[model samples]
Target: MMRASLPLRRGMPTSVLGSVSANLARPSSVLAAPSASKFTSLQSNKAPSNLSKRFYSSKTPNEIASEAQADFDPHAITAMDKQSPPEPGADFNVVIVGAGNINFGSDEGPWNHSFRLEHKLGPRLKVVGLIDPSADRAEKVLDVKRKSFVLSAYKDTIVYPTFADYVRNRDPAKPPHAFWVGSPPAFRGREESGRDLEKALVEAFPNAGIFIEKPVSTGPVDEAFAIAERLKSAGNIVSVGYMLRYLKVVQKMKQILEENNLKVMATNARYIMAYEHTAKLDWWDKSQTCGPIVEQATHFCDLSRYFGGEVDLDSVLAHSLEHFEPAGHLRRVPVPEETIAPEQRIPRITCATWKYTSGAVGSLTHAVALHGYNYSTELDIIADGHSLRLVDPYNAPVLYFRRPGDDHEEVVRYQSDDPFFSEVSNLIDNIELGPGSAPILSSYEDAVKTYALTWQIRNRSEEQVRKLGKGPANF
Candidate 1:
């Protein structure tokens, strides 16, 4: 829960302003030769030798920069549409709202945002502000990521204890070009938590791009839509982080469907998380995390909607394997004593089916049953005589498909694809290059539907439990 923010006022207390360190007036040097043979002031203590350890990176940022490009005309279409370029040294500036796994990648984190930005953009990405209510927690996460990432970009970054603090004391001259919101779903839609900050960001930095991670909100559909309306009015460039939508393999899937003029008939999605890891965490508590479907499986749910189009909310139906379900080959996940009994916990697995407004149908199966630090996520689309399957989207995503009258399944592999980078890059490009860049696929308004679907799946699944008179003990 968020504490009440200080009302907007004139005089700034030195304590709230202590976090601002970057001298916006004194622009740094292209983040000082970010990924070169020579070291820069912003370079990390590490010498950049552990490339093998990273699971998704195919090449170091320097190797990809390819400094050998020929000079282009300033009159080119890309340069023409580009927004007023930043100062000589600053390429992009953003304020990140959270300091959790998404901001700092874990071995088992859903995605990498800050770590990748520092690694790829180096000193060129100026993080002007870092906000979290728990300043100590935010500092800890920053410390860990700083040690691991290639650049120490946030060494002098501003730290705000709350959104209100950032609002009150932020330098009016150096307003960020974009806002990177990685806060939890619970803080996303509620006015006191999400919308208030969102509205403030809009008023404070009109037309600034916002990159929001999913599920965009944990509230009802109407609540999210209300926030979306405000954003639309401000003309803020909004991109919700459904990163899978940017995958080259997913793009190929879309390309083939368009090439063959195919309409999806049915879709299948499965997201089975490694149970040994997640069960011991707060995720096992249904009330806190809003169940696994909304918190975790929502990626697949959004993907299902991506290909299947608008969902018929009335047609959503779901079932689940209860925590108290009988055990045989499957051992029940141990329940935390604090949560009190297995019956009150979220289900071990959930299966749901729903229809698209386009008449196509979709199904999803999510289980918290795999072992160790492993997870399984895959989605398949079936059109008339064509089939499209995407596997292991997080790393080395592969697409397998068969068009009309094909013998065996053909494959398109994008082992080096970084949808995480693509998603964030697109947000920056959309702001800079406008229509010259590919537009964001998942806008704030569109993401509200995905949030609503996850809630619908969770609600209907729990309703099934209630029908059997197997309600939680608290009831």
Candidate 2:
């Protein structure tokens, strides 16, 4: 059965590399901007600001993707690209949950959600509040966003200790329009999942849309399913953070499949990331990040599903390069020997394969043994007479393909297509203009399927981890 998105609104911006970079050493204690003093949330009795004056003409996934691809250019840097982004004249207000690297960005590049929103919607977006465990970090993230995008002036954004706190103190008259949940995996659908948080948000903000990050859960698909059901009934606009689905390269690939009316033969994806000290320590803990497949490489896994359709979860089989295997080869995280038990460490490499419901097969290979802050990633979609490849989506994204009757391969390189900005922008557009006006590429439930598949991959690969008769001499 074909699954049509639940009238969730979505759209994206195109072209130009971003100069912003998030290098927060300790977000909880992120230093105040050089010219600024300490920051504080303002107490406001005023009602939510008026929605920005903006309208959009977008509908259906394929249609939106086609339009974005048509307007996108690999090398056109406009004057707007060089100047500081204009204020977010948002048509709606949203509360951001979690203020981690994914939200604030890190040394690698700008995954900053706030920056993306303002850059795209100009004076149309306004962050009314932030929800995180650390009030300090949440406030700082808002401060940083305020300084960088909204004229270096503090707005009336509030910081709550948790989502529940925000709910308790929310002014019924000044309700937000949406929420962006960017918390880590452990807090998702696992140890202490956001099951309750999701429920609360839906009930409290029935009219607001929701944008959740990937790997909707660390383990177990049930929690995500339940959240999906709640969101469905509430009729809240929903989007998952599988931004890669919005890439022009990916859009072009889908176009090929449709134009030729071809079925996917097989899809193969890989994400080998550098696991230096640059990453948070939680990333190395499988219990926290749920291994590389669940936490990071999920992008490729989701893409695999996007092109190949539903999966045969029972068909999964996997293998991995354990930490004990070449002791010298796998550069270990700097920590005391006793701090990281064997079970806690992530795999050096993981390779898994499974079948799709459509009779097509797919495979994935993930690694976390790089020395620096870079990732080597790629995805290959094979059809009867066509082959599509997307390379290095993290930085400069490019597409390479060979179509029927073509003797040579053609390449499409995007100078800079920030999928992060596109993701947030589309959700806002959907929220402003109402559902069906745009397409939310990754629905919460749809992202759950991707989450479940990654867990299957991680579990299958770990079956052999305990069969070690003798291990490497010790790191």
TM-score leader: 2
Per residue, candidate 2 scores C-alpha lDDT tens digits across 1-475 of 0011000111110100111111223221111111111101010111111210000111323334345443433233322265356554524576777666666665434456666655665665666766665655666666666666474223877776666678788767667887877654334433222335566777778888888766665334555555665666789988888877877677768777876878999999987666554335544554434556765677788888888877777798888887766742554565442455565567788999999867999999887656655567889999987888888765677899998899688998655456666667678778887775655678776776677687678767765454444333321
Q: Candidate 1, which segments miss by more than 4 Å at Cα? A: 1-91, 119-122, 141-152, 193-195, 327-338, 341-343, 473-475
Estimate the TM-score of every prediction.
0.77, 0.78
lDDT of 2 at 160: 68
Clashing pairs in 1: none
* Candidate 2 TM-score, C-alpha based: 0.78
User: What is the alpha-carbon lDDT for the whole of candidate 1?
Assistant: 0.61
**Overall lDDT per candidate, in order of appearance:** 0.61, 0.60
Candidate 1 root-mean-square deviation in Å = 14.7
Q: Ten-residue segment with the worst summed lDDT in candidate 1?
A: 1-10
